[model samples]
Target: MNREIMTFDNVGLAYRRSLNPFSEKNWVLKDISFQLYRGEVLGVIGRNGAGKSTLLRLLAGIIAPNQGSISKERGIRSQLLTLNLGFIHKLSGFDNAIMSLVTQGKTIKEAHELVAGVIDFSGIGHLMDHSVSTYSAGERARLGFAIAMQATPDILLLDEMLGVGDKEFKVKSGKALKERVQSDQTAVLVSHSPTTIRKFCERVLWIEEGAVKALGPADTVLDEYEETAPTRGNSPSKTTTATAA
Candidate 1:
């Protein structure tokens, strides 16, 4: 039997429309319920503004649901992979990398030892000593991606972290992600690319208008989603309007 690692029971999240106490709440995700099994790769797919990223943030415990509950297996650790790694602008890329690792629960010495691998993987060795403010957006993203890949989490939450950087680096990161996903790592991957979902996930969750449209075998849900996906200039059904956040 598959071991359940996490369960979402009628999960809902909302934001206040305004600072006023009387302002209405805008729900980004409503009544979402799902089960994540250990050692399985689950895919999340939806059109823009469908709250995909918000769902990952919820799973990573970065935010709490306003209603309902999300229960995780004891001692389970999750990491959400994003290119916008919070780097101290005044700090050197190397120092920022060390800080990131240390905050992720590594000792300072361990973080220092791990910084070399991050530098090698990011291909930003020459700029490692330079302040992050001096690095280009692409350079920062590369370093961020490298640091995220080094983390070992029970659940890896990916928000299209694949195929990043220059063409060569994209290939390298893709290979690295594939190795992680193919292992015993349990992951929740959100992507617009059906090909990616089909390639990596054992199951798929399709969300529309901040609610589940379908959840089942990946191919089944993907086929249904593709059939209904709006073409350019066409608007989808009116649902919650969030920034895919």
Candidate 2:
């Protein structure tokens, strides 16, 4: 029987601003509801400050929703949300890979094997022996992605991490992502790149003010989103009209 991999029921998130101790609730997200099934890729898009990253974080169970609920069935794993999420500047890439695997419940020997494959996949070869701080941004992203791939997650959540790499690496990684989706793995990718969304995801969700504005087939929704997005040099009208009471 097919099972739902993840579900969000009216999920909401709010946080107190550090500078505004006396302020009331400040909601970053509200009334989110969705279900994800295995073998499906869901693309999420939103304007800046629309809470795209926060939504992904909720799905990954990294933070609790301020209201409502998020549930996940067994056997779900997630990659780092961004390039710098799990990397420690002081740690070598090799050590980071080993630690990532170990923390995910692999034995030391198993971790070694996994890290070897990940290092090869990253194409970093001997660079793995150097501290992550010494690596370029693209290299660090590749290392993080490699470590996550070693985990063999059932559900993968990516948040614009692909933007860090060069064109060649982007092509390679895009192909890898396609294979993952084709192989019955559930994935949620948050990106501003419409091309990436259309290429990998079968469905798309357009989020605004933390609510889903559109959810449907990828091409249809993405087209709608593109048409509605604000373009440069366009601004809201400014007029002054007042009525005396």
Please report the candidate that would top lDDT against the real structure: 1
In angstroms, the error of model 1 at 162 is: 0.9
User: In model 2, where do residues sit more than 4 Å from their true spots?
Assistant: 19-22, 231-245
Model-by-model lDDT, in order?
0.82, 0.77
Model 1 vs. true fold: TM = 0.89
Model 2: residue 24 alpha-carbon error in angstroms? 1.1
Task: Pull out the clashing pairs in model 1.
Answer: none
Cα-based RMSD of candidate 1: 4.3
The ten-residue window of minimal lDDT in model 2 covers 236-245
Q: Give lDDT for model 1.
A: 0.82
